[model samples]
Target: MIEQRDVVIIGGGHNGLTAAAYLAQAGLDVQVLERLDVLGGAAISAEAFAGVDARLSRYSYLVSLLPQRIIDDLGLSIELAPRRYSSYTPVPGGDTGLLVDNHDPMATAESFGALDAEDDVVAWAQFYEGTQHLARALFPTVTDPLLTRSEARAAVGDDRLWDALIEQPVGRTIADTFSNDLVRGVVYTDALIGTFAPNDDATLLANRCFLYHVIGGGTGDWNVPVGGMGAVSGELERAARLAGATLTTGAEVVALTTEKTVRWVDATGVEHETSAEHVLVNCSPHELARLLAAGDAGPASTADGAAAPPAEGAQVKVNLLLSRLPRLRDERVDPAAAFGGTFHINETFSQLQRAYDEAAAGQVPGVIPAEIYCHSLTDPSILGPELRASGAHTLTVFALHVPDRLLTEANNEAMRATLQRAVLDSLNSVLAEPIESLLLTDANGQPCVETKTTRDLEHVLRLPGGSIFHGDLAWPWAEDDEPLDTPARRWGVDTGMPGVLLCGSGARRGGAVSGIAGHNAAMAVLESR
Candidate 1:
């Protein structure tokens, strides 16, 4: 028998759940189908290693892009705790490191002054001041309808800020502003996170990544979720259920048609057909193209008749269960304060470019430039009593420039082992003790340094090409030829098919843990009605 629903969400990830919650709140009957037995998708937590007794944010760690407005509207109980520090980067062969203390600017300035980049202290503040203004004018527009580029310029209200961030390359801005190599890397990291773009490149891909990273909640601070990343999706799931939405796990949608008919199989392998008035997709754009193949409809082409930008993920996620924090090679900084925020290793400006050059030449960086964060330092709620009492911690290391092309099916395991060794070696270079010595052993006595290579993410999370942003991030403003009047087209959530919309990171202004895509998708459905 064919079932009827007002809305059918294709995936049960956080974005999908967000869309379902909003639509159901609007009095629409929404049903969400998830392929996995559990929800949250990549934004999930797990007792990854045996005998660890710790809930690790297996993937998609931390939160920033999720706005408070979405929380209040959904009446969610998710809490994002601010970190005392923003970032700490160890200087080579030095007792001091660059620490950006969130609560103490004097200390941060002192750190910058030690670097002999005294001018950067002022430049750093001015840079963020511009971003703050940009965020004020732009962040609110994310959930609202999209604006043309000219309208966006007017909204930002600062020609110099817009020209530096939007018109010119982010690398140029960083290079011209910051003189120190380390400081340049720190500022440029915002643009390069999860992106494969080089610093000297002219592409605006890095600019889009930078804009999104800095514009989170208008302050651009990435906060730690109090109870692992699962807490985020859990709240969204709760909101959806409270609003009378139906969510089914282990129900993978296998087929779809342009008429809003979806065919999926449940855990029992029993296939069912359902029809909805509207369908919201929370998967990658490529995945959506495959789902709609039966209907002969696909994503719209750009004005230049080019296919959508290539979406290739460029990161290697290493999740470590440490028995204790490794002492820093730099004697001046405490381990807790350093690891509480992003701890950078081997990520200087030239080194980042070198890593990109190596990857471009089909080789991995010898000294992997990665960032690490310890969630337990700020919020230990994600840990069980046993792990917490033992002072065990979870360290999530995200290494950059490892594109999907490097991890082939034939050599995935071998390459992963090699990369893990390289990561440990890199960490040991900056630490007083070898990181491997502090690793927690599971019941089988296996080292608890688990790694998710680009291929692993591709297989496990279904992030096509393992791209975390789902697809290449689009510019927040309207393109030159994009329709000005079409709400769906302008908003970038429109799938271009009747009764179809996007509610995932692939959508415009979508990335990180932000629910803007889902919120926009629901708005599109409501406005259509």
Candidate 2:
């Protein structure tokens, strides 16, 4: 007999756990099925190198965008430990780094000034204000479905919001806000992170939304989870279980067996049926589509009648172990700089765009833009005895859009080495000392690039184009025109299939670790029931 449940959530990612937690809190019998042996999905920690402690890989690292509401609502107090000093952008000149103190724009500016007093004060002030305004204006829209053009205009005002939205590429936004090239480069480069778009690309304005989403407290405050991002997931799972949800890790859902409106799940070789009033999908749209296709279970047809296309986008993740903190030319810099913050290295707009172009053309960019973070510096507990004595560190490099074709080429190994070397060389160029002191150098790492590729991401998470955002955040794709709520269908949290809801980053409000999608999906499920 098929075992029955009130709700069976597919995938045990943070979003999935969040959804299950909320549903169970509301008194629903929820069971989470994860394919992996552990929870956290991409927000996971694993031992990449032997003898080293586990670290976040694939989509690893920090996230401040997780809604405060989720934290409080789930009572994740034990699981959530906020680290001080979010991130840093080290200047090439010397040991100077622009430090962000947990969303305090003023502090960030002051820190920048301390590093360089000349023109940095004025430039940082302007940047702080612009990002502050942009962050406030954009934060609400991320978790919500895009507004209609008229609604967007009304909300943002016809004159101001439209102007910024239409004309503000990263280069333009930075130029309009700051005078210093170093500050501008640091701030603007953020808009291009994880995207295939270049700094000058018009789409970068949309990318700015991403920067806004991750900034906690304010424009500059970033937080590392106490143990790594995996801790966030672990806490979410505990909260879910505490709320009466049953979590089954290593139980990969192989198929969705639906009998009319009712759905059942098949995990591994075990078959379990769940008769829930509503079903919430926390996986990527592409993954969901494939799961449904494999089961012959398609999306609810449109009013006019049509199914949505699969999600797509290519991504590559690299994790490195270091023997010591990065040695920069600027020694006067605080040793704390090694922890709790990101260090970005990109000199100009042209350099940024070339990287994107190379990735688009299926070639590794000569100059890789890296967002390097050291967890040990942020979380003292993770500083194993070996690290304390040796000052070791973990670095995750999110190289955007390396073409899949490169992997098929005979020189793929050479290409990977080249890409790795470029990132190391770039960091060394900006630092005072050679990276050799920091190199732990291990060829063996867990969760290969194949796990994060557009194809694999699509296969696993169902994100079209392997795009993590669910839908594009570009001008044409904003608000009402967003793919989540197209004229033919509504894939956002509320408007999808009556009993089906969306909680992934790709939902209406778009990407990030924020629980907006899950919260919204849960509310929708509760309200419908």
Candidate 3:
């Protein structure tokens, strides 16, 4: 039997849910299909370790780009908690580290003074002031209609600030603006979060990544959701359901047609067909191309009939359940304070650049630059009362410069182990004791540390090459002289097909947990109607 809907959304990730909620609320019949039994995509929470009651955010964590407008519009009940300490970076092999305290300016300044970087105290403030300016000018426009490059630049209003952040390579800006190597590394990490580019990358891919990180919500603060990432997605699920959007999980979409007919197989191996007036895709651009190629009536080329190679991601995610936070070698800073915010390990300015060089040369860096944060410290609700009382916590370590090209199918496991050891070795360098000492045993008497490689993510989620942002991040605005002839093009959701639109990271301005792509796609459909 063939069912019909006004709009059929593929892949019920958070973005798909956002579109479903909006369209359904507007009295359109919407249906969302998801392959997994549960939704949320990368934004999910699970009890990763057996016998561990702590629910760790398994993949993508933190909330920064999610607009408060979306939350209010969808009637979501999500709470974002703030961490007072911005970050703590130990001076490798030294007895002291730099800590940025959000609430205590005097302390943060003193930490810089300890490093003889008293000059950076003013430079750091001035640098962020510029980012805040960009954030204010650009953030409110994310969900609105597309802005041309000239329009965006004029909106920015300052040529010097625009040139520093937008026109030139981000590495040059970091090198010229900040004096201290540690401070420069801290600033540069934002550019390399999910991107695999060097500081002097001529392509300026790092600049685009840095733009999204800083312009989020006009405030540039990454907050922790109260009950882990699942709570955030759960609210979206509730919103979609309440809006009368039909959600069918465990349905794998295998084919899509130019006629807006979607084909999928249900959990029991049942093939079902559905027709829609509009088809909104919530998958990667690369995955969308693969689906079109699978369809009999679909084109053999990319979504827009342009070639789009599979995107390669460059990070390794390792989740750990520890009995307690590990002690730090820096006696000046409290362990609670250091772990509460981002914990930088072996990620100095020169170290990060050299790591990229080594990774590009076909070798994992000897010292992997990694960042760790303790979610339980900010939102204890993710942990069971017993575990909270027992002083147990969750540590999520995201290591950089481990590109997907580094691992092959035959050597994925071996390489994952190697990367894991390198990550821990970097962490252990700043710790008073080995991080393994705090590891909690699971029910099977195994240490509760799980490392996810690129290949593992490809097998689990159809993230081609395990690219978390789906592919390279796109600039938020339209280039000058670009055509906006259709609703898809104007809204930045074009999929080349006439009635299909992209609603995921592939969409312009799409990345992170932000639902801008979904919102834009829905608007495009609504406008067409």
Candidate 4:
């Protein structure tokens, strides 16, 4: 006999677990089916390398935008590691550029004094104030989907908010806000994280919103979860289980059976039919389309019409296991900056744009613009004694300018080797220490290695173009205008199909690790039911 449930959640990622937790808390029987043995999905940590405990993969990283209310409501015990201010732009000569909070901003001003001192101080001050204002205005809209544009306008008032919203790209905004080019460049680079857009692109302002919204406040104070980002996912899983939600790992949902009133999902080879009052999909819209297309042809058409098909976009992520901390000329800056701290390698806006141009042209950038962060520096427990002695670190390089489709037809060995060479070469140009001293370890710590190319992420996660944000963060898609709670057919938590809801990043006000999408989706499901 087919098993039945009041609610069936497909994909046991953080969002799925969040939805399940909330639903169960509301007195519903919810079962979550996850393909992997782990529960966090991309937010998971695994000991891909032998000897090492577990590390976060493509989606591994820190999150600050998660509201305090969720933690309090769920009684989550996940503690965020203390965060330090971020440093940016390591100069080639004896000078090292830094940007930190609580410190005298003059230190950074002096570093760039030769470039343009007057411009630096004036611009940095304005940039700081503007981001502060933007954060105050944008945070509420992100946390609550019910916020209306009029409410947002009222909060910031019409003129200033509209000017910040529509006037300039993030890069330009930073430039216009500050007199210092270094400050503008450093602040503006945050907009490029997890995106394929250039700093000059107007869409980057919205991208900045994505980064800023997740920062809790706008100024880039990032915090890692205790243990690892996996901890956050683990806590969500615990919360789900405590709330009476069933989670089945290593059980992939291969297809969905849909009728006008009900849907059944097949997991792996076993067919588990479930009669649910509601079904929540935590996978990407593109993945949902393929699953529905394989089962119900009619709904497949509707899902496709809702969004574009999954295609490779221009972006790539490189995770490296290092034997020791990289040596830099500025030894004063913590080596942890290599992993948990954010650093941008692009020296100028043109260089940053060229990286995107090369990716758009289906080629790798001659000079990659990267945001490098090492998690081991933030969470020392991951480092064994040998690593701790040598200050070994695990570095995640978010490199732009890699063709989104490079993995589609490239040789795996050649691709890996090429990427390794490129990364080392980039570091050699800036770091004072030897690159060879840092040992390389594989996913299993054996002679073998593990890496996720654009194709791997696309095939496994079904992110179109390997775009993690789901869809581009353009104007109409942001703020109170966001489709999160809207009744639209194209976007929003409401899918027009009653009893069915979207909890993925593709939904309105989507992207990042905030889980607002899932929370909003669950609320929508409850209201509709």
Query: Judged by TM-score, which candidate is best?
Result: 3
TM-scores of the candidates are: 0.97, 0.81, 0.98, 0.88
Alpha-carbon deviation at 393 in model 1, angstroms: 1.4
Where is model 3 poorest over a 10-residue stretch in terms of lDDT?
298-307
TM-score: the better of candidates 2 and 3: 3
Local lDDT at 31 for model 3: 95
| Candidate 1 local lDDT, 162-277, one digit each (tens) | 99989999898899989999999988888988899898768789999999998988888889988899999999999999999999999978877878899999999999999999
Structure candidate 1, residue pairs in collision:
none
Per-candidate clashes come to 0, 27, 0, 16
What is candidate 4's lDDT per residue for 1-529, written digit by digit as tens? 6566778887888888888888899888998888777788777776657766445444657786666677777888877775554555665344455545335566556655645555566656655565566666666565454555466556656566456544556555555566644555566566666566666665454454434543363443567776777788888899889999989887767666565222333344655656677778887777666666666654445442234656334455666677776777666655554333676665456667676777778676777666676777777765566666765677776665565666545564577567656755666676777655675655454532344556566667666667776655433233554454433322356555556677767666566676766777777766655
Off by over 4 Å in 4: 53-58, 92-95, 99-106, 114-118, 178-182, 202-220, 260-268, 299-307, 311-313, 330-340, 410-413, 440-450, 474-491
Model 2, 161-209: lDDT tens digits are: 3464345565665566665556666665556554555555665543445
Tell me the lDDT of model 1 at 65.
Answer: 83
**Higher-lDDT candidate of 2 and 4:** 4
* TM match of model 1 to true structure: 0.97
Superposing all C-alpha atoms, what RMSD in Å does each candidate have to the true structure? 1.9, 4.8, 1.2, 3.5
Relative to the true structure, candidate 3 reaches a TM of 0.98
Clashing pairs in 3: none
> Can you write out model 3's per-residue Cα lDDT over 1-529, one digit (the tens) per residue?
8899999999998999999999999999999999999998888899899887889999888989999889999999999999999999998788788999999999999999999889899989999999999999999999988999999999999999999989999889989988888888998999999899997878989999999999987989999989999998899999999999999999999988667789999999999999999999898887787777777553454454223887888999999888998888887788999988899988889999999999999999989999998899999999999999999999999999999999999999999899999998989999999999999998899999999988888778778788888888888999999888889899999877787998987788888998888899999999999
Best by lDDT: 3
